[model samples]
Target: MELLLKPIIEKPNETGSGHIKAAAPVRWALASLSLSMLMPSLSTSIANIALPTLAQAFGASFQQVQWIVLAYLLAITTLIVSVGKLGDIFGRRRLLLIGISLFTLASLFCGIAPTLSLLLAARGLQGLGAAMMMALTVAMVGGTVPKERTGSAMGLLGTMSAIGTTLGPSLGGILIAGFGWETIFLVNVPLGIANLLLAAHFLPADRPNAKTMQGRPDAIGTLLLALTLAAYALAMTMGRGSFGAVNIGLLLATAFGAALFLLAQAKVKSPLLRLSMFRDSTLTAGLAMSTLVSTVMMATLVVGPFYLSSALGFDAAEVGAIMSAGPLVAALMGVPAGRIVDRFGTHRMTITGLVGMIAGLFLLSAMQGRFGAAGYIGPIAIVTANYALFQAANNTMIMTDIQPEQRGVISGMLNLSRNLGLITGASVMGAVFTFASGVADITAAHAEAVAAGMQITFIIAALLIVATLGVALAGLAFARRASLLEEVS
Candidate 1:
């Protein structure tokens, strides 16, 4: 894989085009890429704040309303890896511009969507655009920045994403209350256009390697991955509502599709996933930790809103405000955590982060129903801070250890792991809510039951963090062993 893609890095040299000469252009490039990256996170949460309004507008159930959110996520999660590889093959700039254009169009459609089905379709389109932006952003940064500064660049980018996540719900709530639910989608229009313009002007072209660009995309691999991911997403989205014949079929198809995809990948000459990348212990450990982190994060996001609106009787605006706290802390702490990774190394920071995360989850788990807003605030803040640290540290560890040539693929894999974890987390938590509430209904009583389920889920999440801490410890021990072995040799 490295050999195949080596020409991409070498081509700029051959063309006498050194690293991007002007600082202004580089900064603009970074800003555009970062903004594009911010869209999906913002879109995801903005809609959360508008869910109740959307439910009313479309006369939809909670389960049906969730599709508005899940549609985009499912599309992006399924396509990110495939699109990232395509960017590596074709051109990152080209893909990015196309993505931004599609995103903008989708946003417009979303704003005007008159029916639930139409809105969901638009959201899925938006996810396709998001996938392109996400796949290219990190790869573009890797291509543009000096090797020494890449970590810092990545850190800043991560911080921006955290900020977007923080802002989305708050902004969404305000827009929904003042203008209506449609304004959330409308909000993306100006930002998307600006990003598109800036990217065209400032971003460098992806000079593809001859070997990699020679062949078309692996069709069989692509189909298998798509089928697998779609099946899994269906099983997740439909599992809670009506587990009838169709749902059962979807779940069974998901199992078969996943199996076939893995088998197909192994046989393909240039596999989409490049399963061998897991050979690196650092990558393996990081991926495992990442999966756990994402699962917890997703569950908390999905469950928190339910808890706030149903359990605590908070309005959409209040729920958005409360939910915003964690991302706010995460945004603040992301850069510092990256700096810590630069100084202290990933292992120590990861272990510390796990400890903090476990502590936070435990605090959340222990919250009593009688506790007021003040009681909830402190624990939620702790959880957010710890999560931010873990995210920054984990990203640094994963990217730093890999070969530069593999950055795009690794980025895709990392994202895939996180998204898959999120999907799984939502499913698991949804199941808990379903079982605990004893029906698909969302009522005050059901809300309390949901809270109980969340409490149990948080405990399980905390245990996962404990398990991750053990993995971190094991990694440290292995590092020591490698060091000793090198010295003796």
Candidate 2:
């Protein structure tokens, strides 16, 4: 047992405290962390591509098979923060191991499930595992690598996430066409096993933190927050682009649940989310900018397809090929973006990224069909590359010096904000495109109408970038003022 659990050779961690810095161990640790980030993101997109196949296999309706995806999404959205808090209370290493095991087992179950209900159940379980992985991976980064290289680590994780998301559709398609839909789920088995072993071997041992041990888990706060997030996710997703009574009711429930959750947090002896954390202007600004930037990014995803297909008369394959550039650019830029952040600082790089996004979006807003695919791809690449830099900078800025015990929950909150933005963008931006097109049915909108809609939608998206830029600049100014005051005192 001692041999099996032997600690890796140690070196200085991000805090200048001792952890693993040996090249081999650090790379292995990074590999495990990268896999943790990849699996959840891959799961998010992979299932969408397999829905049709799953429906046929199970003799299910579109709505029924949709649960395979929705169940996973809802579980992650609702439970991510709660699981993060749990990791802090228990031990991140232990909980992360359990998460990997659950995800692996759930994948096996999902692959072989004979019934739709059974598949959905396994998918929900998989989502629970994903929530744990997504929440803790970033939190674990500070403990895994050197402090000066944190940005690079963040960028690597970002790159892995982009790879997972971008690879999913193509991978799922290949697996389904060659083997079957089952292979899509089954594929995770090998990767999950690899991740588990590497993580078990390479991750730092969880230390005994007296502060964390003394704190009680906030059960009421957890329940209320989960319910609130579930409501919000449902409200954004349920209508499939149209808002109805159910959507309205869910939104109302979200608002109510949020209020109750906030009240509960205030009253709880140990809150799931500490309200005081928001007092840090940097943290608050970072979270706000992340949400805003994510929302704008989603605009590209939602509107790009329609504009390419309807306005430009591109075929499905062409539209897909062109759209792939954004994620491809993001994936390629992640590491370089981190290096830039490391070299120039998060504040400067963040401002640079936002400025680049504004320029891309403004160009997109003025786009005309005469310029063809090159016009669209050019701006998207610029936006995406800069977005990679911005995300790396923002994440590093937020996660850099946070309290160790609070790391898990803070990471979860950052992810949650980004998720909320994506959900909002999918619905709201799509609506804006449709409304600007002056058409009830966007799918069949005329070329000129579609082009007009794309322009207007991007104009709105550019405004969002401008708002995010404001937050970044204001945060910088505030930080400078505070630093000056500290020096004067």
For model 1, state the Cα shift of residue 253 in Å.
2.1
Model 2 lDDT tens row, 103-206: 99999999999899999999999999999999999989989877778888888889889999899999999999999999999999999999999999999988
Scored against the true structure, residue 78 in model 2 reaches a CA lDDT of: 91
Positional deviation of 38 in candidate 1, in angstroms? 1.3
RMSD of each: 6.3, 4.2
Worst 10 residues of 1 by lDDT: 1-10
Residue 222 lDDT, candidate 2, scale 0-100: 92
lDDT of 1: 0.77
Worst 10 residues of 2 by lDDT: 1-10
